[model samples]
Target chain A: MADVLLSAKDIKIRFGGVIAADGINLEVHEGENLAIIGPNGAGKTTFLNISTGYLRPQAGTVTFLGQDITAHLPRTITKLGIARAFQIPQLFLDQTVMENMLIAAASRQGYPSGFKALSRLPEASEMERLLELVGVRSYAERKARELPEGQRKLVDIALALALKPRLLLMDEPTSGVASSEKLEIMDILTAALAKEKVTSVFVEHDMDMVERYAHRVAVWNVGKIQKVGTPAEVLADPKVQQQVIGI
Target chain B: MTRRIKPITTAAVIFFLVSAVAPLFVSSWATLFALILAKGIVVLGIVLLLQAGQVSFGHAMFFAIGAYTSAFWGKYIGGGDILLYLVLGGISSTVFGLIVGLFVVRYREIFFGMLNLAFSMVLWSLLEKMFPYTNGADGIRVARPGLLGFVFTPETFQYVILYVSLLIAAAAFYGVQRYLESPLGHMLRAIKSNETRLEYLGMSARRVLLIGYVISAFLGGIGGTLVAIIQQIATPEFGFWTKSGEFVFIAILGGGAHAFGAFAGAAMFEWVRFYAAAHLADSWQLILGVVLIVIILYAPNGLIGLRQRYRQSGKRGR
Candidate 1:
């Protein structure tokens, strides 16, 4: 009976003829690691977008920390302690990793300009800690564009974590990382999430990672949740197995 | 290029010494002073616009606004008293900047650049069309601007006026540089790089750009006002598209990222224009075009890039 941090009721999103997300109800509790696993085009990303304020649902009410943030601006919603990372790992490529994380922290603190932050020592140290947490501390001085795929993903996660957010919406955090490196990155992410006690509803295609990391698995099919339960329960459901897993 | 020690210090020291003693070389103190002051002011606006990776092609409109404000006030009310003209000119430019920024900052990339040029040209055309009050092509006269109650008729006194104004502009440039290094400026760079990510971070891209736009315009207005006072005329030419192009050209000629780049660019721009006009006359644009093309191709960093390369070479040579 944990307190819910994010609660969405009957959310439906349509893109002309295609319904990206349809009548879905989901909740992520405080300090919980929730996974939304689905096949391609299941509207997993759209659901994440609606929850993070990037996309507005046609019908739904989203309450985060008991506040109705459905109509709030994306920046305002982020300020309310919900942070997200894109699947493609968006970063200021010309900037140093330290500079990237520092800006992220400043944005979270509502520092309007970089001149105001002025590369303060404390901010620099905080950036170092974030980099270390995400296992990219050695790459702090490197330009973001120079980093490899795995490190870039870590930097993206570090930026989201820099916000010190209570809830994180991650889109394919492990996407593009080598198959061997996926578990390592997930392990680092899970440890950081645990340390911060941050709740997350992340989308991933890897079932093994989901089973290993997800506290609760929500299987989505055709923009709707097919089942929500412990890994074993959801994996056992015949409808979920046939429609979602196709096993 | 690459950062080094010895050569950089030597170059900086030489530049500083030359500028400090430059006023002594010219017999006409007024020309020397006016040359530095006017160009320095214009460069301030260019610096601000370049911060967000934007090239403003219509700063001349603000310059024209400032010049007109000073001239209109100087001619009618106070005869262009130095103090009154500058204040009035700054205020007018600030207001115009806020208005134009509202419309211009919404556009991005080439569309943003094009809108600025179009807006400036519109102002120029309007000023020329409403010739009855603006004097159209004839231009407007400026009475000798004064300090306090004393009018500056002496060449030495005019020198003081220009020098003081130049100092103020320099200080303002420093302030802007400091602002650019702040968190707000970083976000602007972030916006330039990936605005979508900024939106995801919970900040509006447009609003941030608007703030930068208005600030740049305010500086542009200040430059225009200085030019009006120095030239003693306010014309529709001040708001011309070519004038805006001049600012963009100067900004690019100077490394947009460097604090002093715009100033160096402006000084070089004015000097080159003077040389081209004196020597090439009708073909001056051809020479200017060649120089621009060369810089764009080989040294895209402009003067700053050249300096960096020179220093790096010196280090390697050693």
Candidate 2:
């Protein structure tokens, strides 16, 4: 069995009487492409939030790399080799695309002397390599806001990869793209992830994309995982049919 | 529209020349000394804080802390040695910054700005209310220092000391610049752009912002201490909210494009204030207000915006 990169046991997050995440147990293995699929308000985003240290679970432990990271800060968690791309493509609108990537790369390296980073040299080359991987090297000089939605998503992915993270959490990675382009973005993502052997746990709504890309699918309903299995098994499950497919 | 000069670089170079070498040409000892130390150092602090996407309205608190600490130590504790006074002032203000920054960092956007103002006002009111320690409405005075156990009655040593202190303060402010332009600085900018996104990336916005806030406060203390040495008196008005507001104005005027924008803003402010005082002292406030309004409306990014506009237009023309 592949070593579990992230293990969550009975993690619960409550909003007053409503539980956003209740007794959710998930184990993400290294080098796996896992998709968490559910209807809106099924607690998929909440699980990602808790796991990434954005929203801490009120009860239960989150262990990453065999250590309890429940008490760790988000920056520390990121530094420990976990990076996330937001659903809305959180690029720095004011800065150039290259500058945004440089910031991400800087965070990974623990912030070297300012002058060294500012001077174009070895770090600049490294920046180019990452941009090339995302196929947006041409847009390097453009501000993030100027990039198309697909390109912005690419930039976000480049930023995540800049950290050289062991785990990549992507929230609706193909969001805002045309239905036809969604698969193409995922193809680009899969190729990039394969190149780095970076494990990805993504929350995606596209059933076709999930069937084609995910190694396993976990169906979430209300605030619990209704079913977890290989794409074929989980998609065929009656529970998923009622909660996710809504048949 | 491109001017062939980047605003950050232009502002930095201009301020550097003025602060570093302008005193050489100016023969008026009083004006030259004030230009180098009081105005220059205070403005440098403004530049540092604004770079981190924070605008301070409590810089006067640090400024006052520097003055008061120096006055108290020189008058009571250390027998008025100028060097000792500066050191003591810096130490006291740093301590003040750490305490105040902890509470202030919890706030965001406008609240952060207002909290700094409130804190400065608190310090100002406390100094005014505590008559015995601070001398209330009457400012406390510091005795002149003996030079290395030798008295220099002619006072040329004062000028040398002022210049040296200003140099060190300028260097310290530059250190802040180096940090801001670094990855850490980019991280702060990222927070400025989108704090929630930073959180999802496994970075804490609170921690990053807190460090920036503390650094700003620390330099504000240093600026304050420099002011104290020059003035020889510490008063409650040093902590006034208006003085804090002035730092904000200066930060904006300088364009906050680079570290020296604060200095440019401060120098212009002092120069204008002096010029107005000479010609129209009673209406100086009105004149200053109108100038600020014009700058804000015409140049929202201050001088920095002009630099950006030039760069963008140049690119287009090319």
Candidate 3:
């Protein structure tokens, strides 16, 4: 068995009268592409939020790298090598793409002192290289808001990669891209993640993309995981096809 | 290795030269120019906070604190040296900022602004009620401040204040410009853009803001100390909410993109008020309001933004 990099046991959270996550238990192994598939409002993103410390599960514990991290701040969790990309690109809109990358890179390097000069830093080349790896090097000097939806998604992923995390959780990596370009975007994205050897847990709705990239698939239905198995096995399950895939 | 001089550095040199030589040419406006520099320093403090997406309407409280600290030290403790009073004022304001920021940093948007206004008003009321020590609303008289150890004549005093204010303002401009180009400054801007993303990158947004708040308070204190020396008075009005509003107004007028914007805005503001009061008397504020509306409607980024746009268009034309 592969070593479990992240473990969430008995996670429960509710909002008002709605149960967002109910008694959910999940384990993500190292070096595997774990795809979380669910219908709309199935609590897939909520579960990811809990693991990344964006939301505190009302009743459960999260252990990462064998340490209890259920109550740690998102910053602390990220510093411990878990990074997240938002469903919509959460970037510094007024800043250039390179500035966004530099901010993320500089943050992981250390807490910046008042005198720590950002200009002419040795990390600029590395930032450009990261942009190049994500196939957005040409857009480096442009403002983040000026980029098209596809490029913005790539920049968002690049920003996540800048944290140098051991694990990356992406929320809808190809949701906003054109239908014709979805596969191409995923191809570049998956290639970059593989080259970096980073474990990934991505919440995606596209079954084709999941079939191509995910090693293991977890089907979430109404705040609970219905089944967890290899992509072929879970996709073939009648229950998953009827409830999640809706085909 | 040869170090390249930035345009800002060259501008600073030119500013210093002009301030030093211009005062000799127009000695009558020396005090007015000194007052502008003092207020400009305070505006620079506001600019820093504005850059971080936080606005403090109670910054005048720090200004008052600095002025009062200098007044008390000079009157009671017999420390009349200008430099010493500047240091004392800056340190006292910074310490106050550190304490207040513990609670203030948690609030954002209007709540943050209102809290600052509330604190400044509290200070204003205390200044008014504590008549015995603060001299009530009538304000207290500040003795003539000495440079180093020498007491100059009134003529020499004006020159001394001008040179000192210019030197301090120039140094602060350079320091703040450097800070804005630093990694910490980038974090500050990041805090403005998307604080959640900043945290997800493993940097504490609140901590960065606290550091900025303390530095801003220090700058406000220095400005207040210079004001006390120039005007030679410490009034409760210094801590008034309107006073704080004026700082905010200057910040908006100058824009928050560059540190020089503060001085430019202050200069234009002082000159506008000077002329408006001279010609329109009671209607000066109305004139100022119209001017601000135009600036907001046309040049939302203030004078700096206007200049940048013009430069960009000029390049395109070429």
From the highest TM-score down, the ranking of the candidates is: 3, 1, 2
Model 2, residue B229: displacement in angstroms? Answer: 2.4
Off by over 4 Å in 3: B1-13, B281-283, B311-318
Candidate 2: residue B6 Cα off by (Å):
5.3
TM-score of chain B of each: 0.89, 0.88, 0.93
- lDDT of candidate 3 over B179-294, digit per residue (tens): 87788888888888899999999998999888888889899999998999898899999999999998888888877788877887787787788889999998888887887898
- Per-model lDDT: 0.78, 0.76, 0.87
lDDT at A181 for candidate 2? 82
- Model 3's CAPRI class is medium
Among these predictions, the greatest lDDT belongs to 3
What DockQ score does model 1 reach against the true complex? 0.65
Worst 10 residues of 1 chain B by lDDT: B1-10
i-RMSD of all predictions: 2.3, 2.5, 1.3
